[model samples]
Target chain A: MAKKPRKKAPKPTPKETAAKAKKPKHPDMEIPFLKNVLVLIALFFLTYYLVGNVKGYKWLQERFIEGNLNKLEKFADLTTDQKYQAYFRFNHQFLTFIRDNTADTAIIYMPPDSVLDVEDKKSAFYTKKRSNSVQHKTWSTYHIYPRKLVYDREKEEIPSFDQYTHVACVDGWGYEYLEYDVPKQQRARYQVLPRTVKGLKAMNEREKNQAQ
Target chain B: MTLIHLIVLFLCGFGLMNLISPKFGLLEKIGFSFPLAHGLVTLLMLPYDLLGIPITLTSLYIPQLLVIAFVGGWLFYKQQLPQAVRIQDWNKAKSFGFLSINLPWIFLMSILGYLLYVVIAKAMFWPTISFDSVAGYDFVGKMIAIEGKVNGSMFDPDLPFYSIRSGYPLYVPGGFGYAYLMGFDSSKITTVLLILSTVVMYYALLLNYVKHTMAALFTTLFITTTEYIAMSALSLSNVPHTFLAVAAVVTIFIWMDKRDHRYFWLGVIFMALNVWARSDGIVFIAGTGLSLLLFAYQEKKWKELIIFGAVSGAAFMIWQVYLSGTLGITNDGVFVDHLFWDGEKFDRMTDLIWRVITNTQFYGVAMIVIPIGILANFRTIHKQHYHLLIAILVSWLAYTALYYQMDNGGENFGYSLKSMINSSYKRGMFAIIGVLYFYVGISPMTQKLSQLIIEPGNPFKPKQ
Candidate 1:
């Protein structure tokens, strides 16, 4: 009984150990084609949902397709000036009238902001709350360029006030600067009148009479 | 005639790009052509006006042609002309059933195409009707075209009719003036072309980072920036400036990632043009320049840094010189020269920025998606994309600080601090949105996701 003993096993070689160490413990796992497809589908839906939630669909349909594409034909035949007219409406019309009536070299005396701010049915040139578009020197000058505009507020600062050859009469406020009398039928709510010598003379006479 | 002018301009840009570097993708060349050409043409107008030369179509066109011929001849002589369009990747993907397998690309493309069509149609159909355009850029542009000079009668001392915005920069006005000189009935064609070119370049640039589906998805997101797209239809400098500034920042980042000299030079040119587009674009220049300084110092590329600084700052300096030295127009204290601190203004600005950025109506889901992507990849932020993130943060901080230090107390166009924060500051966020989306597209999370969708094997599988 004492002589019965088990034998010890031999150790593996270095090469064998190295080969075993190089071998992978687990095989590579291939993702199923269906799983990949599902992931793709999920991503697509997620993106679509996010985009939709952000109003992309509504914007495409309403702002672009309906708002622009549908009106493309209607706006196609319109000339540049006509398109401006459509957008700016009465403000553009008034500016265009000034541009047409005044000479390129004419120095224009622009009406005060008060004249344009008048909201009464008779005296109001712009009935909308957006007043003083015509009275804005920069905006008016943009429409009628090469023609000088002198504002009442800045007339003293601008030495060209004395060189004004025309007056923009808004709601009959600038008629005092005009040399000629206007008939009631011929008078417009907005008109540009030439400041001739006779008008200056009449203005001087009125000033003299007021002084006396 | 419009088509002809555009073609000539494209060739000019193509040639210029070729001169910069012969190695370029076809899409890159085409996408970059118009912006580069337009920038050069507009820049030349300043010198032309200074020298009393009429800025006629002939003056601009002839110089552009010479440039094209020189570039074309040089490339041909060097045998560096592109032999063929390399679309083999697309064909290979198609052959491997990639498109059929990944069907979302179709949806994304469809959305992008539809949006582009509508946006272009809107821009082309409308005349210049925006208050800013009518009173400022368009007005000055029309006068420039008529008088063949920037210092025309409109700038006469006796007639102070031009708006404050007229003195900002001449790029937008020059674009409109170029269109007018080309015999177009409306100058809105400039805006239409800018939108088209920007979209093309944006999508093309995105492709370098992400797969087709991801690129298209982000591009769609970019185009659908609610306020940006709505404003793109009208002629305003904001959208165009957004394009230039975004292009500059993204290209600079691309250079940093790829280490390509060509991209570095391209980034420089675009950065310069960014300032040329709008002076406020200097904020972007500063942001990108600081990043480049770090890059150059680390890489020992002092020469590249010098070139970038010189070229990028050239336009801003020239513009300042022209305004103060030549035109005799001094700043009427619009910008504060020194930096100062204001706790109330700082708090208010931060609050407005947070409100605007979080508002889905302004930027769509861009604000939402960007933060999520960034936080999801928080572990890799320092190692992977800290440079870009820093640039964006620095640029935004500078922009906010610039607005904060301003003397915005006057009645210049009814712009109050709140309105400025709401409108202009909001619009400037377009550049930030664009860059952040680009960052997300290139982030590790997105790249891994892209791999999972494109590759057939399990991304989670252990390596053998």
Candidate 2:
């Protein structure tokens, strides 16, 4: 067929193959009003999402941690070193957990009974009975207070956010309110943190008065 | 790793990202820097055996990181690219337009941030670090350290803990927390976080500067660089608060310029979130919203006026609803609480703002306001852009007046104003600065600079 007129294909109609590319006509096409409305809607939902799902964001891993105290309870005849090792592990993990969760913004609270040795009458944790209703606990020895966030409007002044905690022990010495910043990460390992009130020997009459 | 080692790694990562990037714009720029920040954060993990490096953690794997980088880079690039490459002339653009404007300060800020990390991180072994850092960010960090998640109430239960007020926000916390999660000590991470944040703001403002987006970014940075902003960031929660506040302002300004109104929505959402970021952000959003409404009305932009009114009104209402419904609290209680125990010391604070306006006894205290006035006066030279300068001046003055009025008849009102200025001076200054920056870009001076300072075919052209 003589190559069908040099194999010239049928031309595509305007609707079939392609139409000429048309100009946008308006330079303000980039400034779409609807896109803004859509963006606004998206922003609204995002704010809602962040604000709404806060509870779900809470990490409940701490409650599930296995304390060495539990292991000691199970194995009553454990060695002192074994018990100490477990206590150390439990405390380390607990501290680590707190640091991880709060971004190093947390509080530390120690019970009145835990301030000093239970057997010694002159222990650092010892507290004098002020009256029937009120008693005095020597709280100055163990200074690692719990960190609480407080609101401060003065930007240059103290932090608005603060840490608040009530430390109570097995003994009936009552609860003590403690507040302090999160401990430094580097020193967290080297420093003993006065695990017991007896560990600190710096408290005096003046300091005792100041604590009250 | 040593600081030098970290620096080397950062350079390597930055180089790798730049090589991988398809082109230069928003994502590419961020791509170049994001890896460095991320790598630094991960490298911090080398000290801790339990935590190990973050890259080793399953949650922070390379693939997931790449995905995050891709998404973050893409979105930021998308938003920034439109503003960056859209410029007509590449030569007319300054050398590293985004880099130059911010690099000067960011480098300085990084050094300062590093020094702060070292001083606080190491010295914390002493008992003195106990009172501030321990009770402040360190305590918050400890909570996260133990919990492996962030919680607001841990910092201070007395404050509004329900919102995002207590801890660092998403990007900020991620930058800092990533270090700890990866096993690096927190002190170093804190330094990295501050540096990264400053850089983020630097680039963010640079992008704004490039497209004639806003003036507040430059002014805000200028104000932040002052002793007041520096002191505040060193002391309290305002560092993150300033960032969040600035973000909200940028969104609002973009909305105003483009009138796409989507930015308004973003602004409102950010404003609402800002309140939760820090107690003062609510005030900033409210003040800026009022300014926006007034400006729109003045400009005869009826549509924008309505949008600003509705969005701003709804934001306040939602916060009120949240306070009332969730805590059964009122603004009066919140204000009273702030007054007594929140460390405002109101009278001294207000004095700072008053002195700046009237040029009172405290000359240096108000020195920061000079650049703003100059920026405003320069804008008046061009009749078309005059109203923007006027609006910024009026809004800033109005805020000062409102602050004064609120403190009126109270003891030491001047002090309260001083306190407000001290805390908010940087951000307030920024809002004006960003607008004025846009003014400068359109002014004759900018054209002269483009001819002299910028190269040929510069992309930064004055908008007609």
Tens digits of per-residue lDDT, candidate 2, B55-130, equal 2334444444464465446646656434433243343443233323422233334434543443343222122122
Off by more than 4 A, model 2 = A1-212, B1-145, B148-184, B187-224, B232-235, B258-273, B294-464
Residue-level lDDT tens digits of model 1 in B119-222:
77778777777878877788888988888998877667776676766776778899889989998877888887888788878888887787666776788888
Worst 10 residues of 1 chain B by lDDT: B83-92
Any runs in candidate 1 off by more than 4 Å, and if so which? A1-48, A55-60, A71-79, A118-124, A127-132, A181-186, A197-212, B83-102, B411-414
Task: Tell me the deviation in Å of residue B335 in model 2.
Answer: 2.5
Per residue, candidate 2 scores C-alpha lDDT tens digits across A1-212 of 34545677898787764433332222211223343344335534643553244321111111111222233347566543343234333332333333333313333232332332333555422323211000111111111223332211212343432232222222332222222222334233212132234322332343476679
TM-scores of chain A, one for each prediction: 0.61, 0.17
Residue B164 lDDT (model 1): 68
Which candidate gets the maximum TM-score versus the true structure?
1
Q: For residues A1-212, write the lDDT of model 1, one tens digit per residue.
A: 58867787789899999999654322122233575467657867876676567664456556657778768877788876788777666667777887876668878887777776635556435545342266667777777777878987786797666888888887667877666676777777777777896655655676588789
Residue A174 lDDT in candidate 1: 83
Ten residues in sequence with the least summed lDDT for candidate 2 chain B? B122-131
Candidate 1 backbone clash number: 1
